[model samples]
Target: MSLHEILFIVFSTVVLLFSLMTVLSRRILRSATYLLLVLVATAGIYLWLQYEFMAAVQVALYAGGIVVIIVFSILLTHHIHHRSKPFPPVRVITGLGVAGLGAALTIWAILQHDFHYHEAEPLEVNAKVIGQHLVNTGDGGYALPFEVISVLLLAVLVGAIVVAKKDKANEQTSENK
Candidate 1:
């Protein structure tokens, strides 16, 4: 097989394996670590596709920023060695059924679609073009959704802090009594 095909297979396998590990892990910290692996493998796939900007964003924003925030939140709110309780059989069966249905639908859609592949001149991908696209409010602009996601992340951080503080306060109250 060609090098490109080999690398794609490797990256895809890593992503799939780590994704399952992330979900099935009982320890919250381990789950977060597995998620980081999944994100990094996804970045590898982006790099293989020659989307350098997307790969950088995947590594920097998702692997670096989001995972760090998740780990920090876990550290603040729970013991380092905390393990999640086993999911009930009903939930497990439901989750598997949904996953199977989604996979089947995706395969069906892919089979039904006719993809036309044509070689075209590559567009210049630079920081300036990316920055403009990000800030532009016109067609294909991500400005609004970007701002919304930032606000949502801020809210999540604030909520984590509030929960941690409440836990500490309860602990102090119990000690005093």
Candidate 2:
């Protein structure tokens, strides 16, 4: 009916389709690309909610940064299973059962609760307030989480380096053999 409603429908459909594709596709590269599409569709939904900053962050971080890194990791690691051994049967069944249980729990919780919306005061997204919050000593400050995230990034970088080196070593050993 409305543009917003149409956008919501489109984004929701795209996300669902891409997510299904991400799971169903056998190829690692294709699955990664589909997952990227799903993230982009989620970003579009964030934009529809008027969270432009969050939407941009989702696209840049998930699609551009994380997804690229993931694809690269897959390429470099080369641990992707071929069609003959896509996954172990027991692991696949366990994952599906867990996923089904989680879905059932979420649906039950939704059915049990009656949710109502209340409009809250919007926070200012100005640079000055954001800067203060980023480095402030108060409860509203996000400095701790920000610092922790930097540590996480460093860990990820180190892990990526280790994985890459391991892959290279395996390749060299196989070649030598």
Which of the numbered candidates is closest to the native, going by highest lDDT? 1
Which pairs in model 2 have colliding backbones? Answer: none
Encode model 1's per-residue lDDT on 1-177: one tens digit a residue: 999999999999999999999999899899999999999999999999888877987898788878888888788876669888999999999999999999999999999999999888977879998888899888867788678768867876787788678878888899999
What does candidate 1 score on TM?
Answer: 0.86
Q: State how far residue 2 of model 2 sits from its true place (Å).
A: 3.4
lDDT per residue (tens digit) for residues 1-177 in model 2: 999999999999999899988987888778889999999999999999988977886887678877787777777777566343478889899989999999999999999999998898998888999899979867988688657656766776677778889989989999999
Task: Tell me, by TM-score, which candidate is best.
Answer: 1
What is the C-alpha RMSD, rounded to one decimal, of candidate 1? 2.3
Alpha carbon deviation, residue 36, candidate 1 (Å) = 0.4
TM-score of every candidate: 0.86, 0.80
Show where candidate 2 strays beyond 4 Å.
77-84, 137-140
Evaluated at residue 35, the lDDT of candidate 1 is 98
